[model samples]
Target: MEEVEVVVAHSERATLRVGEVFLKVDADQSRIDVEVEAMSLAPVPTPKVLWRKPPVLAIAALPGATLGRLGGPSTGSPAAWAAAGAAIRKLHDAPLPPRTGRAGRSIVALAAELDAECEALVANGVLPGDLVTRNRQVAEAALRPWTPVFTHGDLQIAHVFVDAGEVTGIIDWSEAGRGDALYDLATFTLGHEEHLDDVIGGYGTDLDLDLDVIHGWWSLRSLLAVRWLIEHGFDPFAPGCEVDVLRARM
Candidate 1:
């Protein structure tokens, strides 16, 4: 018998690692369905699905370390980051998956949502009023519509595994669905902005990306996530953390 390692335990989901097997227990079956189906459809490297039995998804552990951690400097070389970018590009270029209930967020709706959330943050005194306002303004550019691409929904650095400077696998496809491509890019570089060029270079084409929109997504993501993280008993205000990411945008 091996000791069960708690990889992450949140209200909606919990992941436990035992030996070479990782078990993800999610309360939402639709999320799990998206994960399983997306992995099947994605052209990029992903964890091997060992088995599934409602609420529990058993997967084989990947062979490499994660690309990096949020709020921490990445030890991955520029090449590794580039490889991740290339991998994401490949995933994006693949055929679209079947339409689940999830749809891309409309800019108008996103704007309204951002407005409400920013007001809540200020009203609750969760963050400085100026900081919230500034980020709210920055998030405006990202609200515009664009052709939807298959997005990993939550493409955090920790979900990307690299071995020998190559992206061996990506995990946590629960959020995989049609969405804005820049949102994926923004999420990847949220706390690791320095690696943006490496990521863009590896994406294997000039995307003519609007830097402002990218920055906007960064602000929007951090702002929205801060409250959730805090409610979950996780501190986003830690030095050089989510709060730092938002402040950096200012």
Candidate 2:
């Protein structure tokens, strides 16, 4: 019998692993379309799409261990992180996909949303008012203009697979789209700030990125994610978690 393992289950979506196949179910069909198209368009290695039917998309699981877990230090070597960086650069440098991706949210448009989220966090006591305020201020730097690039929208550490110091594959492309290039960099390096240099080293010196904007994204992303995580039964307040990331900015 093939045992079905729940990779993650939340209100918006769920991912199940049965043997070597991963089944993703989502209420939103458009998001699934984005995932399929992004996987097909990305220049970097991605899981093979076994099949797709409406709410269900099945993909063969890629080999090797994840780069790291959220809220934890990554065990991936500097070489592996560099390889991941190189892969991201390739994706960013690739020609834009024929269709726009889901990450089309503009920073200017997100300001109101970020303000509301921060206020809710303060009112709900999800984080210290001062901490939230400071981080919100820092996050403003990321609201400036940026040239859109092909981005993996949700480039969490765990989504990147590495084996023997090489990035074997990158999974989860639902948010892939034309967006700020630094946003991908920020998302990839979220809790793993210590390895930023290694990633940049592998990315090379061709492009000049603003470190302040990157730092701003760290604050912004951590702040906006807290309330949503709580509503979805996640504990972002745990040690070394999103709350800690915000507090670190103080």
RMSD of each: 1.4, 1.2
Lowest-scoring 10 consecutive residues by lDDT in candidate 2? 98-107
Instruction: Please give, for residues 1-250, the per-residue lDDT of candidate 1 as tens digits.
Output: 7999999998999999999999999999989999999999889889999999988999999988987788877989999999999999988777777753233677787778788889889999999999998998898888887877888889999999999999899999988888888898899888889999999999966676898989999999888888999988788988757899889967
Candidate 2 residues 1-250, lDDT tens each?
9999999999999999999999999999888888889888898889999999979999999999988877886889999999988988999999887665544577666899899999998898778889988999999999998888898899999999999878888999988888888899888998888989888888776897888988999999899898889899899888778888888899
C-alpha lDDT values of all predictions: 0.87, 0.88
Instruction: List TM-scores for all candidates, in order.
Output: 0.96, 0.96
- How high a TM-score does candidate 2 get? 0.96
Instruction: List, in order, the clash count of every candidate structure.
Output: 0, 0
